[model samples]
Target: MSLVFATSNKNKFEEARKIAEGHDLELEHRDVPYVEIQADDVVDVVKPSAQQATELLDSPCFVEDAGLFIEVLNGFPGPYSAYVYKTLQNRGILRLMEGKENRRAEFVSAVGYCEPGYEPRIFKGKVRGTITKESRGSGGFGFDPIFMPDLGEGGTFAEMSTEMKDALSHRGESIEKLVKWYVRNNRADGDRNESDS
Candidate 1:
């Protein structure tokens, strides 16, 4: 089965492709310019984005949105993570945590799947971690330089390989759940049959 991924980021595309391959589905990147709406919650943002992408392409597609929530900041960048990352970067986050002992945070990912004439399905995944005083690693992008997973050593996501990071990443977990839902609901049965033929 083939599904359009509503994103232009090549790294995100590669990761989605890897996950889709594991579920026997083919992921096709669609360069759709989605108007990211400002919403009070993640669900609001994700569902609309998925709907817009599906409507524009007139086909089945999926969109993913993630955010980093800091306990100390009371989720300051909950839905505005991208904006925060762009402006503040890692150094800004580090500065915010300067002299503070409580450095807890979590990465939350929401994956929305939209199909023609069907209601969208949303899947969520979260990974706990702490903000580091200094950025580490150079493997991943975005907040990966300072976002350290709780399970791993005192290194940020940038320090981990793609495989290692995806294996334990919130986005990966969300993708896994989304794939399982698709299979159980037989939403891609037609595509599966076509591929078999």
Candidate 2:
């Protein structure tokens, strides 16, 4: 099976490819920018975008949105994580954690898939960990250097390689869930048609 992920982010696309390979499927990347609405959950934000991308591209596609939710901040920067990363960056985020004890944080990803005739399906994954006091590595983007997963040695996402991070990333997990579900449902090319109003 082959499908396109509605994103130009190389990191995300690459991760999808890796996960797809395990499922005996092919994953490709495409640029499909959509109006990302401010929503309380990542599912709401991704569903519309996924549907719009399928409409524009006329292909089976999925859109992903991931956020960094800090416990100390009362889940702040949850839906606004992208905006916060753009402005505050890693340094500013560390500063916000200065002299703070509760550094628990979770990285959550929601992936929405849309076919022409089917309702968008949302798959979600989450990784719970603590915020590092300082940035650690130079490999990843966004809050990778600060967000550590509770998986192995407790290293920051940036500190891990693409393969290592993909093994445990929220986005990777979500993509895998989608692929598995699609396969179980007997998905095929052109299985669904566009809905007419």
Candidate 3:
């Protein structure tokens, strides 16, 4: 009936709730201090955290991780987006792009889910865009103000409303995939229960 999402980011918590609501499901948020392993791939980074989180909570839980990769920078912060954000923030990123001609980039998100007896399931999402010339708008977080997605009218993620951003976000897309998996499994589970009954 409910799923647990383990993350420290309240922004992620809110988006996961929206994703669940969109699919007629309930999601509970917990900032479980699960260990996140540093890795080259997003999936690898998130799965261990998911495993530890579910074990700690003894419940079906998921962990989401994301990154912003820029083409010009040769993916300088592919799996290290969080660290880059903490160190460089937005202005530093813009400075890195000061004279670059190639501005292509994308945001990638990976969601990992786990239960006690099964392997963690991984779902991923990506959104293509470019780094803006300067920060724009006043919403969203992290690199939102500097990264403009290709989905909308040349607006940064920070410019879009939560509803608008959710519609085209990497997190939203991954959550959509996750919700589909949940729905299919839930239906199969209900069918099994019915047969048993």
- Top of the candidates by TM-score: 3
| Candidate 1: stretches off by over 4 Å | 184-197
Global Cα lDDT for candidate 1: 0.81
Instruction: Tell me the tens digit of each residue's lDDT in model 2 across 73-176.
Output: 89978978989999999999899999999999999999888987677878888889999999999987889999889896778989998888888888878887
Candidate 1, residue 158: the lDDT equals: 90
Q: Which ten residues in a row have the lowest lDDT in candidate 2?
A: 188-197
The best candidate in terms of lDDT: 3
Candidate 2 segments whose C-alpha is farther than 4 A from its true place: 186-197
In angstroms, give how far residue 34 of model 1 lies from its true place: 1.8
lDDT of 1 by residue, 43-111 (tens): 778888988998999988889888899898998778898899889988888898899888899998888
RMSD of each: 4.9, 4.0, 4.8
Instruction: Report, for every candidate in turn, its global Cα lDDT versus the true structure.
Output: 0.81, 0.84, 0.85
Error of model 1, residue 163, in angstroms? 1.3
Clash counts per candidate, in order, are 2, 0, 0
Model 3 per-residue lDDT at 185: 89
TM-score of 3: 0.92
Candidate 2: TM-score?
0.91
Residue range 138-167, candidate 3, lDDT tens digits = 998889999888888779999999888888
Sort by TM-score, top down from the best: 3, 2, 1
